[model samples]
Target: MYEFRELAKDVYAFLQPPLVWYSNAGVIVGDKDVIVVDSLANAAMTKNLLSEIRRVTDKPIRFLINTHSHADHVYTNHLFPEATVITTHSGREQTKANLELQGEHSASYAKFFPEFDFSGGRYTVQDMCFRGTFSLYQGAREVRVIELGAGHSESDVVVYLPSEKIAFCGDVFLKGMPPLPLEGHVSQTIAHYKLLESFEAEVYVPGHGEAGTLAHVRVQREQLERQFERARECFQKGMSYDEALRAFAGDVIPLEFQRVVILASYCEFTGRHPETKDPASQSHMSLIQSVADELRVLLGTKEVDKKVAMSR
Candidate 1:
């Protein structure tokens, strides 16, 4: 079941009912008004969040702040038609494009998940869009929404509540899961993380996973930096994309995730191309050769299980 937990006196987070993936929604309630961070993936789930908010206060929900333009983050935005929806200018464009794309293809995607229905529904675009910093005041409290340009997505925004020392960071950081670098550049992502570290928020709310501290965010930042640096080193050494893919893949880690990351990294490093030979194929091959050689050396010193587990 979906449940909402109060993270602070005026902050509340809701865990979406577990499905294939988990997502979170948050609310910042002031004495006179409230603001919702992101809408859930579907109408029913978003309605549940609205119900929860109604339970705590009768104050109207004045703002719907979208962190990015991902379908899961803004799909149910139409539910809050009365609220002024706000997001980065790029996010607004992406959201409009995504909605049109989803409306045309969501039925096909829904076939993969027979449990949920995706019919003639549509998402609402942001009413207000900004390029840099935007602020909104609810009674005496001020909420600052800042766009940290092109990190996780082209329009990633972090909402900060200075009075409470709390931040609702969108998909820029996740707690436990290795961040999915699908629509992002590694360098920009790293810079975004560094900017986040500079903030003095006591509580950090992620778009996914549990709420955490600045230390946790720092660790994730470091992990991404390491991954990108390693990938770049391999690329600089004349390693093909496929060679790099195989160098990292093994029986220990799932092949699908590895392939996706390798391909995504290749696109980030070399730029996407349809006519050129598949660079990922070459990188994958090199990766396999490197891993095999490393394994052989480790086998002489440790058990196979220990060696395999240590790779990650």
Candidate 2:
């Protein structure tokens, strides 16, 4: 079950549901309809979210703004048949690439997460794709969707409600800790932070954990800076990326999150060989597989657990 918190007027965030990968979803209610942001991980989870949305309002679902292409964020795209989907062109590109890249190995993921089957998951690149920014007019209110170049993921999007001074920042701003740096460029997270600061929102909704303010955002910046510094130091020492990753502990970041961020940042520092083909992509694929394997042992889990992910 997810707790709904009305952050502004009729805008509510479905906080920390069990089936999600520690991600959140939101609904902005209007007089006649509603707009949603970030669907859940799989069909089952999306169905759960739909039922929750129905319980909250009888208005027709109007729009679905996808924050990014992460499986946990966009796999339910097909479930919202009535909603007009929206995402950035870059976001769409990344979504397609991710689906192509991870589509086959989904069986591997299913081995660990039986509840989530990425194998047959459908990819909806959103009904509309904008490059920089787009605005939606709901009755008298305006919702602006801005593309944050690349952050936790490639071309992450944030929903800004100027009227409420609340920003629904997807994975770009995780609540309690340093958000994962999984983009092709680790430098993007730095710029992402800068953009977030510019927003100056009174209330911020994160993809995971709970809702927070600027203080939580500051914590995110500091933690990420520390990660970058360590990564840089390791790089200067001519240490292997794997070596740099080995040096990280749960204190700086939980090993799992730190591993992914480190891998992405490290590969970024080196270079991405267009992760479509075999050998070059294998490097990343193997790293992800190993990381998942590590997570499995650390949590003693044959299946991924939401509670453990949330507690972090």
Candidate 3:
């Protein structure tokens, strides 16, 4: 009912409402069956998504393809028990690790944002795994799933429909949101952009935010390059992370976005996450910096870690 739009033919995208994880899902109506790109955050969200799918198409959903293994994108895998769940080998492993890791921190996270929920024990792992490329055929339609590598995560992939000229890009091409450097390699992310472009798809659906075109992807790619360069410039100038943060916060995007870039830069330059992870532990400055970097990336809020100021 909100902003679900058809990208091409019978292909559709479900844009997440703001209060949720701000993720999106893609739906493809095959000749005789249906293929789902990703699931929503939890049971309730999946239920809502399923209702929307039913509204547009009555064909049976034969396959559930996860672009990646992020909890927001794959937590509802259990709901589609009838369909085969698909992901890359690394994606499946990361999904399992993510489930365990998220479960461990859900309590602390819930305390911060009450909307955080994954229905407790309601997650399904991948039923089928692929190494690099996989394809599915339903009636006359064909869908291609290609692994672009561990750019956003350990293993990131995108779904492309050759006939429709549409690509269901996961978090690999965030629109307004800051491009997360989870793998600590923004350069690899640039290369993945080329991979996505190679598809020659007219329409691109990002896992988060709105659906856009290759031009949008190109702009974001340029922004990512500049963001990386700016971070490096700040570091090379011997500016503290805070100084660099202030030098750019609200300069291009929002402070939250700047923090994401700074966090990524710190993680990339340091070659490791701050050794001390707990924010309240008053751990080493490195740990405090690392924790703040991680927190800003996880939650895009204006809150800054005051302790980071003490490092100066």
Candidate 4:
């Protein structure tokens, strides 16, 4: 059984079973209705969430709010067939795209989890969608669902319960590990953080971290700023993406972090901005230059071991 921790009077969080790197779900039980902030990665995980919610309240789930379109976040929407699945306009669109790629995506994951069933056999599609801010009344308490603009994805929403002083932030801030900017624009992501900080929530529940204060969110913002600045500096210096990654290497930086930085830098140099239409061609001169520049930085920093350098 997965452990459910109550972060506030009506708010609860549970770690997804099976130890999937960074996945968690939350429940908000109001006086009259219940709202699930995010569904789990698969049918089994969603079942666990539903069972746990039943333990706390018999009230029907009035809404299933998706924070983004990530498979881990929305794949289980079908579990709550009766509840309305709501998300930002962009989120809805993205989920539809995700569904189209579900087969291919699942196959990729199956490669990693060879023994596990990757097909989300029980997952359902979201039926309802909204834009900007929308409020729902659960008896007397009002639950505000607002899209804080493109940050982690083209469409990401943050749930706020002013009455409870609690906020459900999906993937905007991950505790312990550095923030993941997989599908985001650095400038917009930083801006989104500032907007999130302006909210008056006392407790913030991240998509993949311990429930804590808004300060935790701010820390993520700081880290993102540092990464963006580093990337930008490398770009200005005409360092290639790989070179930038090599230059930034340190004992404190992990291999995964280096890979992400390199990818992000490459994307930036190639002018592959998120939230935009796909490019006609993936190849670009800017990307080549960026990679070359990055390589130079790496060689100068001497971070790559002699063996690794020779291997390259």
Global lDDT scores for all candidate models:
0.70, 0.72, 0.72, 0.67
* TM per candidate: 0.81, 0.82, 0.82, 0.81
Q: Write the per-residue lDDT of candidate 4 for residues 118-226, one digit (tens) a residue.
A: 3454335687888879898877777888887775667778888888888888877666545556553666667777877888578887776467688888887887787
For model 1, the superposed segments whose C-alpha errors exceed 4 Å read: 17-21, 111-121, 251-261, 273-312
Better of 1 and 2 by TM-score: 2
lDDT of 2 by residue, 1-312 (tens): 456788878888877732235478989988888899998765655665777778878999989999988777887788888999888898888787766766564755565455444532566677888888888878788898998877677788999898888889998887743466766567788777777777788988888767988777877877777777788788789877656756886463467667666666667777852222322124544544444455445545634455443333
Q: Which stretches of candidate 2 lie over 4 Å from their true place?
A: 17-20, 97-105, 115-121, 249-252, 273-312
lDDT, residue 311, model 2: 30
Give the per-residue lDDT digits (tens) of candidate 3, residues 97-173: 76667655465445544534556334567999998787888667789899888777778889999989999988888
Per-residue lDDT, model 3, residue 232, is: 92
Backbone N/Cα/C clashes per model: 21, 0, 0, 12
Model 3 whole-model lDDT (C-alpha atoms): 0.72
TM-score of 1: 0.81
